[model samples]
Target chain A: MLWLTFILAGLATTLPRASFIVLGGRVRLPPTLQRALRYAPAAALAAIVVPDVLVVAGDFAPLNPNLAGVSAAVAAALLSRNPWLPFIAGMVALHALRWLPGG
Target chain B: MPSASFRAGAREGFLAFLPLSVGLVPWAMVTGMAMVGAGFTPVQAMGMNFIVFAGTAQLGTLPLIVAGVPLWLIVVTALALNLRFVIFSAAIAPGFRGAALPMRWFAGHLLTDGVFACCLEKMLAVDDSRWRLGYYLAPSIWSWALWQVFTLIGVFAAGVIPKHWSLEFMATIALLMLLVPLARQRPMLVAAAAAGATAVVLRGMPLRLGLIVAIAVGIGAGFAAEHWQDKEEAP
Candidate 1:
């Protein structure tokens, strides 16, 4: 079942990537759809990340360590152009928050 | 033999992508680590790396797989995360028009965000199809190789790493990293904020349906924001 899931997931991504390329000039996506697609990555990523960081064990926790870590990540992202900085900052922040005296 | 322009384009493409390749290392490793940390066997983790070849989708769907959600839902989630590729394909499809079917399929399969941006920029400057193809494939192949190698390292390393480090959170951070940049634009910002808030509020929903709902709400909010921005900008 797990293997099947991976295969299907692969197909899901591949089909879209291949959609226009293989179909050639015969078809075209509507312009409105193209504009909406720009936000798909941001929206989907936020939907995935928010629940993971903001919710702890299936409940919303506004003061969680993960929030602090993500905040640090956002700060790093804005301050530095290097993509690695945010991840490093985020992981360090998460660890620091987790290991803090009472936290 | 390929033409000189193709060779030059390939060299340019590789050099152009070299700097960006460094950033993918940590992201790929975290993805590999997250896969193993999520309880997937090393084999399964590597399989996903090769098969999906998409870091965000792999990370996005890990929790779902761990939660034992329905297969369709996992695929749908992955698809939603990958919808950006459709736009990418559409943008680049013109460059590959009239190319062989297999080559087109192969090129599309290898398409990625970094390669798309780099290749698209080069494609616009040159009219030669061969040069464009070379530019597209050079970074596409290099990035694929780099991603696989790093991800494999992470998969095996996860076996020895302590579980308490919570490495899976790295995946979330990686996703956050991807999200933050896109959020710089107003519409994208609105979309991310709306989606994130919605997902948090709906986190308790069964079958992880909240993710799908949040994505829809986010897209709607982003579209509306874009429309409003256009209206305001118009004289």
Candidate 2:
């Protein structure tokens, strides 16, 4: 089942990416459809990230260490486009929270 | 003789991709480690990496699969996350029109965000078709090679890295950073926030169905924002 899942997953993932190359010569996508596709990455990433970071063990805890850490990271990301800063700030905040007494 | 233009194309592709390749290293490692930590065997993780070759889709599906989500849901989510690649394909298709069928197939498989961006920038600049193969191949080959090597290191080294290192947190932040650049517009930001809020509220849903719901809502919100903006501009 695991291997089958991966195989099917590969097919699902590859077909769309490959579609335009294979079929694009004959068919053209409209411009508006293309523009709307831009929102996908942000939406998809948010869907993956929010649950893992904000909801710990199936409950919302806005004041938790991870959330606090992510707050610091999000601030860094907004300030500078450098990709590494967010992760660094997040790690530093997470560890700092851990070091706090009774945290 | 293989054309001098092809050689030049290849050289340009490699040079252009060098900086992006450096940026990909840490992202690759995080993906690799995340896969191992998610409970995939080294072999399985590498297999997924080889076949899927997409970090975002792979990472997005991991938690769901870990929770034993239905296979169809996982597949749908992966496809949704990868929908942008279809746009990339449309954008780059014209460059490969003259290539043979099998070569075009290979190029399609090799198309990645970084490689596609590099190749498209170069393709648009030069009108000649003779160099397209080399230009496309160079970055694709380099990205695949580097991604495989780094992911392998992460999978094998997973055990040695302590859990307390909090690598999951690192992965989340990395993903968020990736999200930052993409959310340039108000609609995109609204989409992200709506998705996050939806995911948080629906986190208890079985098989991570909440994620699917969130993605739908977010995309709808973005679409609606665009629609409203269009309406406002209509005179």
Candidate 3:
């Protein structure tokens, strides 16, 4: 069953990727729908990320080590184009925050 | 035998992807370790990586799978996380138009966020279809290879890493890197803010249904923001 789930998941991901390419000129997405689709990635990513950082054990906690780390990450990302900078900043901030006395 | 222009394009693509490959290492390793940490055997983890080839969807569905959500629900979640690829495919579809069916299908299957960005940038500057195809494939294959190699390393190293390190959080950080850049524009910023707020409010929803709702709300918010901006700009 697990393997079957993996297969179905693969199909779900690939089908959309293959949709427009395979159908070619036979199909055209409306401009409005295309613009909406452009937001899907950012929105989906935010939906996955926000709760993970803010919610702690079923409670919403505004202040936490995770939030601090993510804030450092966001700052690093804004400052530099290098993807590694933010990743390294986030990990370092996370570890440092966790090590603090009150944390 | 491929032509000289295709070969040149391929070379440029590979070189261009070299710097970006370094960033993928930690992300791929974290993903692999997360899979093993979630109770998947190394073999199972590798199988998932091979078939899925989507880091976001794989990570998004991992917790739900461990919680034993329904299979259909898992598929739906994966699909929703991957909806962005539909836009990517459409953007590059013209380059693949009229190509052989097998080639088109293969290329579409290999499409990814990094590859799409690189391919589109090069496609804008070049007019040759063959060169564009070569440009796309070279980086696509290179990144795919790098991803597999690093993921395998992580799978084996999962046992050595301490659980206290909280390595799964790295996956979240990696995602944040992807998200932060996309949120630079006002409408995108509004979209991300709306989605984040919605997810927090609905965090208690069962089966992670809040994620889907949050994405829907975010897209609507972003579209509304864009429409408003256009109206303000018009006479």
**Chain B TM-score in each of the candidates:** 0.74, 0.73, 0.79
Off by over 4 Å in 3: B3-21, B64-70, B87-92, B117-127, B205-207, B233-235
What residue pairs clash in candidate 3, if any at all? none
DockQ, each predicted model: 0.59, 0.53, 0.63
Flag the better candidate by lDDT, 2 or 3: 3
Give the per-residue lDDT of model 2 (tens digit) for B114-145: 67644675664576676877888888899889
The model with the greater DockQ, 1 or 2, is 1
Task: Please provide, for model 3 over B1-235, each residue's C-alpha lDDT reduced to its tens digit, 9 standing for 90 to 100.
Answer: 9878778888888887665556667778988998998999989999999999888788879998999989999998888777767777876676765477888888888888766744665664578877777888898888888889989999999999998887777777776776765788899899999989998998888657787789889989999999999999999
Over A18-78, each residue of candidate 1 has an lDDT whose tens digit, in order, gives 9888887788777677566556667777887888887787777879888888899889888
lDDT of 3 at A11: 96
Error of 1 at B229 (Å): 2.6
Among these predicted structures, which one has the highest lDDT?
3
True contacts kept of 3: 0.73
Error of 2 at B97 (Å): 5.1
Give one digit per residue, the lDDT tens place, for model 1 in B85-137.
77678766777855789999899899887677456646646788888788888
TM-score of chain B of 3: 0.79
